[model samples]
Target: MLEGRSCLIPRPPLSSSGDQESTCFYMRYGIIKEGSEEEEEDEEKIDDRGKRRKSQDLVIASSSREIQIEQTPHERNDYSSVEDLIAPIGRDISINCLLSCSRSDYGSIASLNRSFRSLIRSGEIYKLRRRMGIAEHWVYFSCNVLEWEAYDPYRQRWIALPRMPPNECFMCSDKESLAVGTELLVFGKEVTSHIVLRYSMLTNSWSPGKEMNSPRCLFGSASLGEKAIVAGGTDARGNILSSAELYNSELQTWETLPSMNRPRKMCSGVFMDGKYYVIGGMASSTEVLTCGEEYDPIRGVWRLIANMSSGLKCASGAPPLVAVVNNKLYAADYASKEVREYDKVNNSWITLGRLPERHVSVNGWGVAFRACGERLMVIGGPRGLGGGMIELNSWIPDKNPPLWIMIASKHSGSFVYNCAVMSC
Candidate 1:
């Protein structure tokens, strides 16, 4: 069979003038042909040999049986020693084809050769995919303190991430998670200091996180593309912060942004209409702030909107349960078990419909409500026999009403400690 046969095509090396020569090698089965005007005589000589060899006669007996083909001096210049991702095809075309592949196949593709492993580990493929507006939404959530899992809604498959590094202090401390670019950052505290742990999709491994300009916990954060913004949380020494910082995943650096108008903690952040908004947080232990702040990255300004979270906040509840899909704002009201949509003009919330009947949460603490691409994802489970089940419920916002569909479920603790969505 033709499967037992292989060919290698190599282009000529660059000339002394730093220009690529036009010499090209074309190989099919066990025959090698030169692509240049000077090789016309050689081509005619091969054509004169018995109407060219038949295709079936070119098949090698076995994969280990290497066919001996004659080559010119340039073709024998050890070009195979050079690591090309996919031989015969140029690097640019190979990258384009790799970009079209599903992210789940990256592991298999990386195993092909060192060049492929480097390409996948360097995060270049994701960058190219982003430039082409190609993205897939992966829902990452942590049920146990040190365990995280990813769910692919489109593929209906679950991928368990590498176990987070063992740190007793970090495991016990309250943590926050954000997925920016291909990295998942988990923010928590060490024995006496705040620490950040990072999980990379490219390497499929966890590493120590890069420190932010201002280290804090219980902060409101959201990611858009390769950048993420964290704002208004408590810093060390139990002081509430009004500061904000922007994280660039590509550079793995954080930049200080203009502080918010007011100091607030226990808030939630979301990006809508190309702006970052912080909603429904506690200004103080006794004071619950109903105001929200909108940050315009282009203008470098934060505008305060009064009563923006009037009915969305609860005195003894967790942060506002908010998500954004298609640049539209949504919230899950744990108290009423309802879903609400934001009215941009009125700066108010409109009750859309009820949440999934079995999707239960405690004062918005245990459940995770996030935007997975074009769908709203509710991740939580109702308390049941034994431990409980973790269910992924999804719904697309429409003119009619919300209809949540149970897409996937698993047996686990009902509570979700942290969650984030990575789209790339």
Candidate 2:
């Protein structure tokens, strides 16, 4: 396993000679900027429980940080890197065409050289890749009942990952997954305690990440670029946790965050409008909670939001998967059989559309719903009735009279636990 480094990715440097090749790279891809002062050091406020907040990750996923590693064109003349390979194709069109490769090919490309590895790991690649209109997004799914698999929506194929690590008495379904930097993080209880496993796209291998401070099941989680937040789940003793924590992807560290006002489990989390919102869950195994809370990482505080009176009121009773797009929050309410968008300004929910029809669609447990690029997708099947096939359906809200499109389907022995998207 590769060790974590500074979360910041170094910007490519132009040769001092101002060579034609270097200038071409500059013309196609401009320099990326640093974060503003407010984003860097906004308000170092204390949490409700009186604890200081940790520093935000590099640039909260959109930008890099100050720790620079100079990779001038002349400095890399001796070794061939992905930059070198693409340097000749300085123009945007050819670079994007090369970038539109299969997801399974990234690991080999990254291993070509130091330059290729560094370029593949940087956020700049993602920005450039998207701008060129050649960015391809792949979805990783953990059935929780078996092993992990990734789907290339563009190619309509399934790629198997390494079997889920060490599963004697462990089942990973009650888990949460997110993409922080280039790794896929899967966290949840493994038999007795909460464990985390990190999957590297560059290495195409699985390794253990930092374990959770508290062992939890049915917790809320969301990604913040280079870092991620997970809150409110049931502990080993079946106690709902008010406790929350943050994961520093670069340091591979887990730090405790301020606990919530009330204990909750099986909650849904969505990062929207610069804050993290955790929705409806259960305080105990049997008691369902109607309230929700939003946390501002900048102010380091949590404010209570409106109570959830809509469908999927209980966490365990429904899947309660939440996602964000266009600065709005949308969730899959399995109980209602409809996906709803939450309007923070109006404090109301307007029905957006319905989930793909399934025999047992009324209940959404084991189903996974997440945002992919500009679209929202849900993956699950009505397996409860008997062994059935799984489905991947997606929606683009910008379209008039939005309709759900079934992207792919597969026969499976179990339901999905968690899902994440990577734009490579």
Best by lDDT: 1
- For 281-334, candidate 2 gives per-residue lDDT tens digits of 887767777778888888888887656535556534764667886677787777
Per-candidate clashes, comma-separated = 0, 1
As a whole number from 0 to 100, the lDDT of residue 323 in candidate 1 is 97
For each candidate, what TM-score against the reference?
Answer: 0.80, 0.70
The worst-scoring run of ten residues by lDDT in candidate 1 lies at: 21-30
Error of 2 at 368 (Å): 1.9
Give the per-residue Cα lDDT of candidate 2 at 325. 68
What is residue 254's positional error in candidate 2, in angstroms?
1.8
